[model samples]
Target: MSTADDTQKTKDPEYLSTLERGLRVLNAFDADHPELPLSEVATITGLSPAVARRCLHTLLELGYVGKNGRRFILKPKVLEFGSAYLHSMNLEQVATPYLQKLRDQTGDSSSLAVLSGDEILYLVHVSTERKIRLGASVGTRFPVHATSLGRALMAYQPDSVIDAYLDTVELRKFTEHTITAKAELEKRLRKIRQQGHDSAQDELDYGIVSVAVPIFDTNRQVVASVNCSTSTTRVSREKLIEERLPLLQDAAIEIELALKKWPFLANSLRG
Candidate 1:
């Protein structure tokens, strides 16, 4: 992509096509694609081979990407970007201790996340040593329609935004319990509003049960979410909620209060 290409695509005259193309190339690499051939990168990013090659060459020179034989792979240097953003926000610093407390109290895994696009991106995750299924960490993304964290943050979105989400996202079922119907999910969101939190049992992954609460900003806007997860074999959905919901709410409140000092951060992450 170039300045000339912008005439056919974006209306912004100041748009930098080279930077956008480079980022598109980088975005092509993900958990499922740890290594991708040059041709594959071009295909995935919808870039011509010449353009993708140029972008990869630049990243390779900058040590942000490495080539292993015929395939391209992201280097540790790329993490500096995400790490810089996390350090700047400082949300993890304020919320991790509370998440740890939730884990300790419930003997389950706890996590912090925010709505990113149509998914919930994990910003912080505190896990128990005893793992069952589906591992997650910072930067992990899951469909917002299938997890407690997703429902918690999404239930508070304005009707227009929620309508846009429903219009855009593909409601694919991850498990038998996953809500794949728009009407049903709309009802669920209403119920979440009536109560104060969201819970999922065998919705995203089988045997996984989690409950989450939305953390709000000073303006009462939902900014992020925190969740505690365990297994269905160990804890029933009712038991999980009975024991963990209040603790999750307390954590959300504490995080909200702590975020007041960093008012910019609260708004920055508002979903």
Candidate 2:
């Protein structure tokens, strides 16, 4: 198999080596191993403990990692790395204005979310004036089984991917309305695929209804999804479909247009 070095040959060797190792160290930590001692980190990344300590110390100095006793763990400040990518994506930047427009039109909270692993990670969010709206934020993570964004993305993924996700991740019940049965979840995903959208009612959090549509890449593959959420007290299912669905669909199309202009996405399209 071709390695990262074979694929990427850059002129700046020093900068490349530093950036590569730093990312490897960050990749060494995840949900299963949220914290690690220097020796463990070295083992995970195949680095010397002394070298690992230096990298961890550098991350600690930058406020990205914190020393919990003798162990190193990621800090909330590590979100800066994700934020940097989100900020650079002009699609997300331009979509913010359009999302705000959707909020103004429907008086509902709207968000841009992407499927990450088995979860939906919110990237951009806009809130409405309603006091009882959905309380999710830009960096919040929600379960794939219970969120509208997750359903929309799943509707477009290969059946094997969806099956693998359901087989691997535990379907913890978040609310009485949440679907825990894998068979039911598969049934719902089929409906979502047929409709090209999803409406999740209080499955994630009580009193919140989330509606989502898939955002497509230039090849018409699902790249991400956009959602509008409102409290059950504020909007009925019929009203949401009648009023907000059009706006969400329009915003998603605009986001697709904006996505095409991004250098990374453009290159991906070419390749």
Candidate 2 per-residue lDDT, tens place, 75-98, comes to 999788776767666645657888
Decoy 1 TM-score against native: 0.94
lDDT for model 2 comes to 0.82
Runs with alpha carbons beyond 4 Å of true place in candidate 1: 1-9
> Once superposed on the true structure, which residue ranges of model 2 sit more than 4 Å away at CA?
1-55, 61-63, 67-79, 131-134, 266-271
Candidate 1, residues 1-271: lDDT per residue as tens digits? 3555557557776778789999999999998999999999999999999999999999999999999999999999999998998899886678888899888888999999999989999999998887778889999999999999999989999989999898878998988889999999999998998898999988888989999888898999998989989888889999999988888889888898989989878877873
TM-score of each: 0.94, 0.76
